[model samples]
Target chain A: MTLTTTLIAGLVLGGTYALVAMGLTLQYGIARIMNLAYGDMIITAAFAAFVVQALPSMNPLTGLAIVVPGGFIFGYLVYVFLLSPLVKRAPDKATLEVDSILTTFGLLFVIQGVLLVLFGSNYTSYTFLNVPVSIFGTTVAANRLIALVLALTIGLMFYALLTRTRWGTALRAVAVSPQSAKLVGINTDRAAAVAFAMGTALAAAGGTVISMYQTFTATGGVVFTMKALIVVIMGGVGNLLGALTAGLVLGIVETTVSTYLDPGLTLAATYTIFLAVLLWRPEGLFGRRV
Target chain B: MLTLDALSVRYGKHIALDNVHLRVDPGETVVILGANGAGKSSLLKAISGLVTPEPGVSITLDGHELAGVAPHRIPDEGIALVPEGRGIFTALTVDENLALGAYSRRARAGEARQRDFIFDLFPRLAERRKQIAGTMSGGEQQMVAIGRALMSNPRLLMLDEPSLGLAPVVVGELFDALGRIGASGVALLLVEQNVTISLELAARGYLLEVGRVVGEGSAAELKEDPAVRQAFLGLNA
Candidate 1:
């Protein structure tokens, strides 16, 4: 019974991690943006969900319809206004990486500051579908179950889109080889912008789901960012399926450690696994050596 | 027709191409023959919009000027370049690579037919449609590159050293495939160091030396020229 509970809880947490990590992977992989501000985007959407839930008839799912598109537009505008110039000026990928990291680091503070001013530094969450539901003789919160289902559905849909559609294939081509993508007549800049926007949309969706079951402070964006980054690197950067698997593994391990050992050691356990992966497989678990 | 007039490209202090003038008529096969560092790759790169030519240079496909067109847009203008080193997406499957070949709007309408044509042209690609391209041998990768370029339904197909580093037997088969592609009425602009096979494949040839076109003639005329025989064919006449 305890094992089943741990597995379910870990899966719920892992589903959210997978959801968020996919967005980061898309941004870093296709757009080539490190996106240090990614978690801030999530928190922003969470706050948006919170505000919507406080209204008379609005719900987080309804908030998703607004927040996801808003996230996409915000990301597109950011790319056009904030990042395109850097892309044009940079001579090579290495230079672009350095430039983007610095630019987004500044962007991180700007977004976090805005979030702080708007929502304050208080831990915020909303109660939604808090009823307990039984699954295989274990009871879990209905909201968390919904989040898991939504995350898996969205992630799988995204995976299908990437593998099935021509446009998605072109995006993957850009990620795989941008120069070669141009040879096939793909506008790499436009693709990057769209990819960045899609990533942001996913981040928004993840945030909306997370808001239902977890309390998130405006200043706590860094932790989400770190966790997502860890999952992305563990799965292999730019690899969608890898991100999903790595996220679940990380979630289960974290949960198992917190349950069996001490909850205080979860972060230490996370870092231990991360350091081991880095030392053993720096390219990532699924990444191939170039 | 594709026309280039006074095309010049420089890399810092070194001029890679100098006032090069050339043309490829519809459905015609033209080959550029030169030794190493003779600016062969630059000419193809210039046409494909991968490299910017000097100001006042003119590059037109049919009646449209292509001097400042973006590289990705060039495929939409009916030009496809199989660059040196076979720039196929190594991470993608053969089918996915070919599907992406028809990504340009112009090629999208005829994607199905173009894919069929590619499969017919390189039957090996049909068998390896699901296989990751990076695992293929060098010659097979070149086939994927050519098939990918053809999938764009290009009017003018440009190749830069397609036979480089391939085994002699593979080179022979590759040219045989190129010969069939030429027969299908796509104008071919080839840059090759292998003089004998290229001269046989092309109706006309241009000799580029030090980034300039030093000689131009029919294949038969150049094949018999003593200077060509000595310089390229390695025959002391």
Candidate 2:
């Protein structure tokens, strides 16, 4: 694939991946909790969306009518109930990261087990009114294009929320110093819980799209999770613009190589690029100054 | 007005602040003077709601009990603690940090009016409004910290060691700011190792040693006492 074609494909894919990877970047960036269970949690969300869509008279996209709210609720519950209790207002950036990874991985195991019991061991695809769309003469599967557009639109919306709103400003304020935040009457934990739910909803939303774009098994989520991590890592933590850039960069690279070579090796190339960039720019390609 | 009755803090086996009692009236400025381990810092922390106290002991702020009041709620109760080390948010600009202090009063009438009041108190801060707080000089950071505490529209502002490390001239400048603040009629609870200036700026003071209040009197009495002058003010200086 040429650069233009690769870019077009990459933009769509990158936008999608950015949505998925954003939660992890934020989790790692602020409190420094590593979310190793990124893939499994998302897969669980996909299955949940699948179950909703499977309802006798429901459209899968309409499942988003269920998934978005459902996603926020469940994600908020997970943060407040599960993760918030174990972590301090500001835990050690390194150790809690590993603990977060382990904890999420455990969630992955539990979710996969539940899915295996209920949905059985099988591949699934959501095919609700498949439509085709074109962008810059690029042929886009209707479902993928909508997902891509939604992912980018949401990314921008969050960017605005973070920069514009008082709540968002308080969230960043808590990010600066919990002690100072408290002095100003900002509840540090509430902000963290909100961030967790907000990030998780974005990830779950990615699950809705991924459910349609490819065949998914209860276990098919790990590779995509790793790929999303690559995008997030390259983008840098706590940086929405950087995440967007990294996601698109990964999208373009992976799409071009997968077009020319076997798609299976896309992960290998992604990991290689991830390591190289991380080695070159330890904070990330465009990480915030510490 | 503020009062602490039998206030104490224990860190496991270590007694950081043994039983201590003190009181301040409205429009009165008081300083607690001590050496490094004299619990002067802990006394301020206790008043600020940052330290745990022995139960049943009361820390009252403007007649409201504040012993166990949450840290964030302290400011709203009309007391602000400019904690030790000038706990300004390093990443925030001076203006943003100060505005956050004023946020508690946003729902109340006259918040913008209060913010403009702070800008006048610290003209240097107003001049460097866009600078990151951590990047500023020590005297400037101290001004930001004091300005931030004032932004809470506090009835009582508690300062812990505001003159930790600075030139004598800078320290003199800080005392001038405190004098202006006092003239405005806000009561201050100061913890300082610099005994002469602490007593000079304050109306009354207590001397602490090993977590206990060992000396108490009007600032004039303390300055005149031989033991206080010898132990704290260094009589010749």
Candidate 3:
């Protein structure tokens, strides 16, 4: 009974982790950039939420409402301002990816440092609304449940965006062949900027939702980032369905370990599972690992 | 009509094209022939705005002078290149690949017409519309490339080695399709290494040697040139 409960709880939490990984997968998949700052950018989003909480006019969730779209715009600017300049000099995929990783790492360090300086080091927790609901004989946290719903919804929306819409088609075309897309009059630079922004915005949204459920610090992004990379690799780069299944798998595993052993061992178990999955079947659950 | 007046391109100190000049009047077919390092691909790239030429070396499309226009605007200028190596969006499905070709606002306006035209032109594309382009045969992908270019409704179409590495039968079919396209009034600029076939298919042709126009004439005139026959057509010099 305890195991089942743990599994259920873990699955819900895993849904949130999937949300975190979506952005990572998107940027990596389309642009072929690692997006190292994606995790830290979430930390930036969390801080943005904290600022909203401190304000008299808003709560944390409302702050997220304001910040989510803004985060996308901000992310777009980051790609345009920071990443675009480097892309010009890079002619191949490997070099562009390396440059993106280095640049994102620099960006992540700067963002985390700024937050630490402004907010101090103590962990902060806040909830816009906390309402519990019973589901299939189990009590589910409203925020986790909400995160699960929003994560899946956004993930699906993201998939639809890439596949169905004209803008999505243009983006996918750019991802596949920038030269051909341009020859047909698709603005590849604009497409790259948009994809980068959208991916980063999801990172912000993930941070906003996850922060509401638990305490967070200036340093939580790296952890979240690692978890996201695991999910992305497991799911497959640029593969939406792959991320979802991988997210659920990671969730179930973490919850099961926490239930059976010590909470301290959860990280180890997660890593163990990640390595095992990686070694046994590198393509992840549904995605091709490479 | 499109004209390149002394267009020159360089990679560092190395010259890719050296003050090369050519002209393609509206509703005409012209072929550029060359060896491996003969700057044939660079010429197409320059005209498409993928590479910039030195100052005073100009590309004029209907006399607008496309000196620094970006790649996205090239199609809007009534010019589209079916680039060498069949640059199809392999990860996308066939329909998605064709749909993306309608990126220009003008192209988008008559998308249905373009789609219908493509379906008629390449029936195989319509049959495998949902399949990923990467999974298709080489000849089929080339058809998709040409069909995608046509969706933009370009007045001037440039094909860079459309027959590269394909079987002779596939090349024959492609040229036959090209003849149909030429008859439809779209000016064609063909870059090819297959000297005899290109000249045979084209109304007029330019033979390029290290980025310079070494020979230019009507197909029949060039075919009769003793020097041309030896150098390009594998006849005795």
- 2 versus 3: better TM-score goes to: 3
Q: Write down the lDDT of every candidate, Cα atoms only.
A: 0.91, 0.78, 0.83
Regions of candidate 1 where Cα sits further than 4 Å from its true position: A288-290
- The residue-by-residue lDDT of candidate 1 on A1-290, one tens digit each, is 39888999899899999999999999999999999989988988899889987788888878788888999999899999999999999999999999999998899899999988988999998899999999989999999999999989989998889889999999989998888899889999999999999999888988998999999998888888999999999988888999988888988999988898889999999899899889999778997511
Q: What does DockQ give for each predicted structure?
A: 0.70, 0.51, 0.60
**True-structure lDDT of candidate 1:** 0.91
lDDT of 1 by residue, B124-226 (tens): 9999999899989999999999999998999999999999999999999999999999999999999998999999999998999989998999999989978
Candidate 2 segments whose C-alpha is farther than 4 A from its true place:
A29-32, A53-62, A88-99, A260-264, B105-108, B127-131
Docking quality of model 1: it rates as: medium
Chain A vs native chain A, TM-score per candidate? 0.97, 0.89, 0.91
Looking only at chain B, model 1 earns a TM-score of 0.98
Residue runs of model 3 more than 4 Å from their true location after superposition: A1-4, A53-61, A91-93, A276-290
Candidate 1's error at A236, in angstroms? 0.9
TM-score winner between 1 and 2, please give it. 1
User: Model 2, range A5-87, lDDT digits (tens) per residue?
Assistant: 66777777888888887766665555455666667667877887878888988866788778867767877887777788677
> What tens digits encode model 2's per-residue C-alpha lDDT throughout B1-237?
788888888878888787899999998999988889888887877777767787768888767898888777777788787888888877667877777776665324656766677677778887999898889999999988888888878888889998899888999989988988888888988998888788889999888888998889999988887768888767752
Tell me the lDDT of model 2 at A47: 86
